[model samples]
Target: MVRERKYLGAETNAPVSIICNCCCKRCARKRQRRCLPPEIIFNILLHLPALVIRDVMRHVCREWNLMIRSPYFIHHHLRNSIGGIIIQPLFLAGKSTYVVMRRGCLEISEFDCGFAYAIRTSCNGLTLIPDSRDIYTLYVINPLMKQRTALPPFPHTVDIHSEFKLAFVEASMEYKVVNARGPKPLNPPKQIAMLTIGVDRVWRHIDVQHLPLTARTALTTFPLVTGGYVHWIGETFVLTLSAETETFCEFPMPQLERGFRKFLPMDGNLSVVYCSNELSRDVWEMDSETGEWTMLLSFDLKPLLHRFKDLFSNEKSVTYLGWLAVREVLVLSTICFQRHCIAYNVKTGEIQSFELGTDCSNTKPKVYNFVAHKNSLVCLEGGF
Candidate 1:
């Protein structure tokens, strides 16, 4: 007969056979078998999705609880994870909301955040959001684990035009939130406050130099992390912020066709999508080493004319979200008739559409924010 083993360092599949009563007695008299080796357990757990590990496996026992919480496991998990999209709909007047829609899943899991007007970009699976009740107060949250911590309020009133950015610093293994606000983009921000949570609760100002002439233009978009730098797309150039060094570098963007331009993080670099002439679109990738741009794919909305005539008729254009490398599909959103998205296959010219269901009617802002995300065990604790 076989019984469960709980001793550490034990082989997971090895069983001691007791053929006779004497052998059984001797086995029982001897020290109990050691539990499974940590290496073997780690290998087994590494294959499970982050949701399973966070919700199910972590609750199995004390050993598992500690294993999942360990820094080693967390780093590995965050590195290998492929995240879904975090959808935050800006309704007219209702409770602020957040939800995650994993690719290939029809239903979404909602994360409760009390009435908040803005949902900041996510970094390593954690999102920083301003509390609706008090816009000055911020909450850093891991929706998958339902873990959250509030940040100390800003010394001065937080501006509505200010942008919030979350980033993971590898050197210190910490998460930092940057609040950048200014009346114009070309000029340096009036105030740039940064806080490294868990290490210091106080916010400190960052001294930025070599400002871009275009900085005077107000920034309406959030920052994206890729290739070890946090990037913000400006009118003339892309602003790159080093996560480790906390410094800024500017790179010029490829000339566009005078339509719509968007920057998305993909394949470890910045991917740019520019739409022009109302129907023609081009997708390019920037080389991190040489700063060269490469055209990966192009799209013609002519084929979509038959199915999505409403889009072309009303002059509504497509918004490039991100790419699904594993599936080789391009993600895009549109608001021609209503809020919806299209998944266009790169290898094969196939297209599918999905309704985002954001209830844009009667909303004051009438806009929704969407971002590509992956679940990570990047801990919110510890300091640099």
Candidate 2:
């Protein structure tokens, strides 16, 4: 063929052009066949660690950066995310220490916050940390992202064994912080403060006059937030607030004065946990839609608490902190003098204890709190 074309150079040029055109068409077809859909790309990236998404994958290209920060991606990441137990020791717990036990692993990680704040509760990957020096000064921090939002201070001191809460308002699709400052024996804040994240420039004060007189006398330590409402233990009843309507609802909890009763959010419903010195633990679930409370899980902590009795003093107490939903483990803090973390398996009925630290001060605990923490790349309009 070459010998025949050697004498016809002009004819060979057309054949060469035809071959080049056919090669270009084949390359185009290959590119089209190999290109992946956006949905498939999203699913593939979802399995990667949040650190990879924020640091490595996002920087790979502009399209990736946009998708990683998108709302849908953030929402789905949160939905599939697994949370761990975050522990704050009482003494240095206020200032520096944070102990984290991640899910599906036994290894413990501890780090210093490099500041002073009593970490109280976590909701949707953010924690409500109130300053230990000034109880009214509050901050919402995403420890995993190393982002912090210092909320405006309250007008006065919230001194009555206060508990702060971070909750979401479904109607506005915004996060809200509630002071939940329980009443002190001496002075009680006339009005409670509420702040709408990324919306309210300053703290919004709501009067407590409409609330029951007992509301001023006592406030619960644990607050359950679902949708737009936040529920807390009042002096003698359960107090709920609609963050959207700014209205209030009050209901009575089961009358149990002998045990350390705390409110827990469990199984998409509100749960009440009562741990007594009598070595018994009762978990009651309440239908979120209906205000009905039903006793479902009752377990004897004798076998579970017996093995860890050496960790606490004779006057030791057991408090059910919160449930680890993905792991089916109930977090309990056993404290007589020092605090020890005990995880109770709901299915296996087995318990494992963890010490916060090995040092002497770590053994003698203070007013620390433990909450479920999920490391998420939840980008908000607000600074956090």
Candidate 3:
């Protein structure tokens, strides 16, 4: 379905036209002769993918463009959008560039960012790019819309590992930029910074001294955002923060031997992937209300070892990307410098693997999509 574009940031050389079955120019001519009814056009376009609506359909004519940009259309389009794995090269200020889908399907796109910034996290289709050189500067951007809203710089210093995340708070009916990561665990910052998307040009400081979890930040784990809550998975305990209440909660992680444990959002609940060794990995689901853990399934990756024997790094590492709730689990893993990802069909026990194509000779720090991305015409400043 996405043959026109290459995976992992390669652009489609051919132009796309979503108007009728004709090319863009031909469709324009047809439009001039006898335009369709606005109601018909709106209904027809709503069924099309967000990428098509954003990149091709909206450019068909002024009338279509106006309709696509309307708040109602964007709102409904987002509601209908399921979103997918969005990957963009984490380019440092002095580094090269790359791109992917802002949301929905398996399409990736390239756009003009004007300058370089590594994408740290994304929520509800909007990506949060934290400036590498400037610890204080953060950009909340809609890659599809090619628009951005930069958060004012922080007044003081932040930990090098101070990670940032973009999240939506259902209770408040607002979006927020959260930086709960603090300095070295032993000397944690007394307050964490958060900014309400549209209303705050400046960050609102919240006291963290009283938080249930220790002052430690997610040094290595990428926090998971779901159900208006931010969860940080650690070896011993799980730390959670409520975006709405500005409160923190901690719970014990399942007691298992030391292994690589990652928290994934599965079927509206928190799922855990634990790999005790290179041979097998177990997946578990947690019930937040009762603090109970359920064993979902286990993936015996050992049988698939030869598939990556020549490439897998020391850890034989497997990083969970995202998943299709109905069937598959997508994960990123493999090779020394280059990247490889796989999608496992749980029902069929099929492991479909592909390369993300890092194409490097040596290893270095890199970033990938921490969550499924959605594409939106949402204007951060406008609070849409």
Q: C-alpha displacement of 290 in model 3, angstroms?
A: 7.5
lDDT (CA) for every model shown? 0.64, 0.64, 0.62
Evaluate residue 40 in candidate 1 and report its C-alpha lDDT on the 0 to 100 scale. 88
Tell me the tens digit of each residue's lDDT in model 2 across 1-384.
323334334655656546567878999999779978889989988877565677788887778778878878877877666556566655453332333334543445664443465455667777776666665667677766677777876655665323566777655668887775634424554676788987888878888876666765443344666545677666567677777777677767766676577677763467876775466667777666556778767677666656766654332366567776532578777554435677777656766767565555544447665656666787554322
Candidate 1 residue 384 Cα shift, in angstroms, is 21
Supply the global lDDT for candidate 2.
Answer: 0.64
Candidate 3 Cα errors over 4 Å, as ranges: 1-47, 59-67, 88-114, 131-135, 159-162, 182-186, 212-222, 255-258, 265-269, 276-278, 287-293, 312-319, 324-327, 357-371
Whichever of 2 and 3 has more lDDT, that candidate is: 2
Error of 1 at 41 (Å): 3.8
Deviation of model 2 at 219, angstroms: 4.4
What order do you get sorting by TM-score, best first? 1, 2, 3
| RMSD, one per candidate, in order | 6.9, 6.6, 11.3
lDDT of 3 by residue, 41-115 (tens): 888887787667877898887888888878788777776665555444544322322222222223333444444
